[model samples]
Target: MKLVGLSRQIVLSMMAIALGVTLLVILTSYAFYFLWRIYWPEQACEDSWIPTGPEWVWMIGATICGLALAVVVAVNLSRRILVPLNSVADSIRRMAQGDLDARAVAGDRSLGEASQLADDFNALANQLQRVTEEQAFWNAAIAHELRTPVTILRGRLQGLAEGVFMPDESQFRSLLAQVEGLGRLIEDLRVVSLAESGHLHLQVREANLAAEANAVVDMVGDALQARGQRAILELDTQPVRCDPVRMRQALLALLDNVRRYAVPGQVRIQSHAKNGWCELSVEDDGPGVPEDFIPHAFTAFRRAEGARSGGSGLGLAVVAAIARAHGGHAECRKAAGGGTVFTLIWPDLPETGLPGSNRSGRA
Candidate 1:
């Protein structure tokens, strides 16, 4: 009985109640008949031996029919509501086991409030799954990027201090370079942590997404040229409501990534408005991220499986977190021309028209 559905329980309860009422009615009728016969045969139901037993027989049969009717009505009504609940429960169970694609099997009909709840649940789960996977990749990349510099510096310093070789100027210069690399790695980690922790303050104001892209391009232009790469800026004329400082931070992180992978290549920054949201994108012309690794590229400490780069790998991770903090999302995927494309999506807003608003040149 417990294993059976709620509809069954409802139907049974309705039938039981109906049967009890019918039995009570029949008993009251028989009691009245007996009292009349005993006190005055003249008024004994207008006829002596009126066959009350036959009347009771018909009443008992009607009682059974009423119970059956109650059962049918209860079943139809309860099943309509309970089935959707069961379907949603099943879908939730499947999803809990990691089936992100699992959706509630609401039939040809909807479940009203429950239907909305199921929809919200599935959406939240899907987003959470993507974020979690991104986090893992980023953590691994950070480890990979930070480990390289620290490992190199430690190995070189040990060799020098142990007097394993003559203290030559060339070796001393190598040591100096390693120390500088380590310093850069530490700073990158610090920035990445701040962005991810959501403790960093945001000075929100109206700004142009396109201009922000151009500014990031200018800042990283020199670095790209030094590495034999070029950065091209293209911006949409649309304005957006955002923090210029935070936006630049995200852009700088992305450009840094471009420098690492697109050496001897080029990066193009483009912005446009789409479906009420402004999009800012930076595309690179490097060996595109592999089919599997693209999903994890924005994750901190994620190194392309066997991919090499200098300093720390927190650049993309920081960009993603900063974008999210500003009511936007950062995404990276395989791009045309066999490279990666990263896009930032945010709500479109009018510029605040404030003076000296640009903060990209601050650092």
Candidate 2:
């Protein structure tokens, strides 16, 4: 029914009912006038009221003309409103049936409201086309990324099993590592996609900027310890207003970047608050970014040459996206000790501090 054309029988039936009512009204009203004349006495002046045969015929003709006019009016109105609506309806149906090229074309003088609607419909169709193209590109890129690792693992396993190569533990471990890298890349891609697309539901709550940084600090504590590194938390303002989960994700991404780039014993988490906004900075002793590379760092799949960065190149991109989604930004600067300092600021504060108290989380 959605794909089919509009039902003409339904439309005509409605018009038939309307015409029938008009006929009934004309006949009943004139009939009453005729009966009234029959019951009343003739006028003293015959000129004043005459019940001639021709007058009756003229009155009957006029009634028929009025009824005909009423029917014409009803039919035109029904066609003007319903027919255009049906055309737009048909266009929608075709579009829903996967006809990407379908468009709802509206004729002018159609209440003008439907013209606006058709404009919206055409705009949506154009957007769908663009999205379809982008999705195709994204799929191709992912397939290429996946195939590289798979091909390597497959070749290595085949060689080992067929005795074409010696059963070396290091060789097998390398292959396994490649496979694991692919897996991590896929997962990180998924996470960044969801986070950037605003599909990751945020559990917004008040949390301590220092404490949140410290927790991520704790998670990486062992790895940093193994490298003779330590995390320092210095927050002048205790609590910051924002969602804990999302903010933590941003911080973790930054921390991961710092670990990959900075020297050991170079981690610092410092924060400051002024006006309504609070900012927390994560600085490290890593080499500062080249001036030209600073702007490109936040783009997905972008990395500096010789950076030796592990994980998907989505860390900084995700951090940027998450910050903007929360109505703020992530800023980069040179640390006091000459490492990179990334400050995540909260420009907007919720009226009620949610989930956790921002005041208590201060170190």
Candidate 3:
């Protein structure tokens, strides 16, 4: 009943048709024999009820016709079911061979599980294509970012070696700075990789959120002052369990982003408990991010038009990674007054009196 691994529906249909034809043949033959015996008793008394040659011919012909009909129906049904599956298999094969653009085309009549399978395959193909494109972009961006600092270091070293440039303190300091920048870029890439791969090392302990925020502000205070910018802190004293060093690193990244992108205005840092989460936010009163670019703001190597400085664009991405490692998340939004606000939220730790508790003063 099965032809070319056809669907169960087709197999069952063929079986039913064959069975019906067999019953019809048997009943019709017996009925004809009974009529012959009733009309001609002498033939019946001859003691042979076996089918004569002409009667056998009629039954064979009917059976052949019925089988032909069954064969036609089975073939047609198999075609209807197998054609789409074949197309899907071929498309998958092409995709496995690196043709990300290959896609399965389901026929208009395809329904039920076959249609769903086609839809799922197409969706997976689209996702793979997108990831491939993003990987290409990452490679290009990283190369460009590394090339600048490396080129500078190489040129400076060559000049010094050839006596074209003097080995003065200032010259050496500049070279050292370029080397440091390159090292930082490499380290940032490592951090992002670790975070994405769920291998980032975290030393979790109870720490005061306010103290951490103030420390971060103090760390970046000089830069803000040089830019003629003022930072305000409104931290709520709360003890949260997190890796203090990693948390500070995340805060520093956010501060660096503000320093690089935001205009000279009042920068606000706030931390407070909201709902079941503790939220830490950095807000500025300068030009805000564009609406269209907000979604990709945290992506590595992504920069807005206002980002003209020499940045590798991994600052916010690292922040996001750290937040996720802490069972939290980061978000960017337009600040109410102006400019943009970046928020990091983590689940609130249970109330406990730790060493850093009761320290609520702002910096």
Judging by lDDT against the true structure, name the best candidate: 3
Off by over 4 Å in 2: 1-51, 71-76, 109-113, 123-131, 163-173, 193-237, 241-248, 252-271, 280-313, 324-363
Sort all candidates by lDDT, best to worst. 3, 2, 1
| Candidate structures ordered by TM-score, highest first | 3, 2, 1
TM-score of 3: 0.82
Summarize candidate 1's per-residue lDDT along 1-363 as a digit string, tens digits. Answer: 442444454556666767766776687568756876787676554654555664667567667766676777767756766666777788788878988677665542433554555566667777877877867876676576667667877887788789885689988788788777777667667656665665544556767867777777777788889988887777777666777777887788788877877647778888877676777788888777888987887766667866775636667877776676556778878876888898888765433332212334322
Candidate 1 has what TM-score?
A: 0.53
Per-residue lDDT over 1-363 for candidate 2, one digit per residue giving the tens place of the 0 to 100 score: 432122444455567767776776677768756765776446322563656664577578767876776677667766766655776788889978988788877654534565667677878889997788767866776676677788888998899899987888899789879977886676567766765666544455556767777788888888777766678878664565677666777888888888777777768878777898778778887678766777787777767777874556777877876676566778877666667888777664772433222333311
lDDT at residue 304 of model 2 (Cα atoms):
76
Q: Model 3 has how many clashing residue pairs?
A: 0
RMSD of 3: 6.3
Per-residue CA lDDT of candidate 3, range 1-363, in tens? Answer: 434322555557778787878877888778867877888767765655787765787788778878887888777766766666777899999988989999887653534456556778889999899989988998999999999998999999999999999999999999989988888788789878887777765666678988988888888999988887799999888677766777788888888888877889888999888676778899988689999889999899988866676788998998888787667889999988878999998775432322121223211
| Candidate of highest TM-score | 3
Clashing pairs in 3: none
Clashing pairs in 2: none
Residue-pair clash count for candidate 2: 0
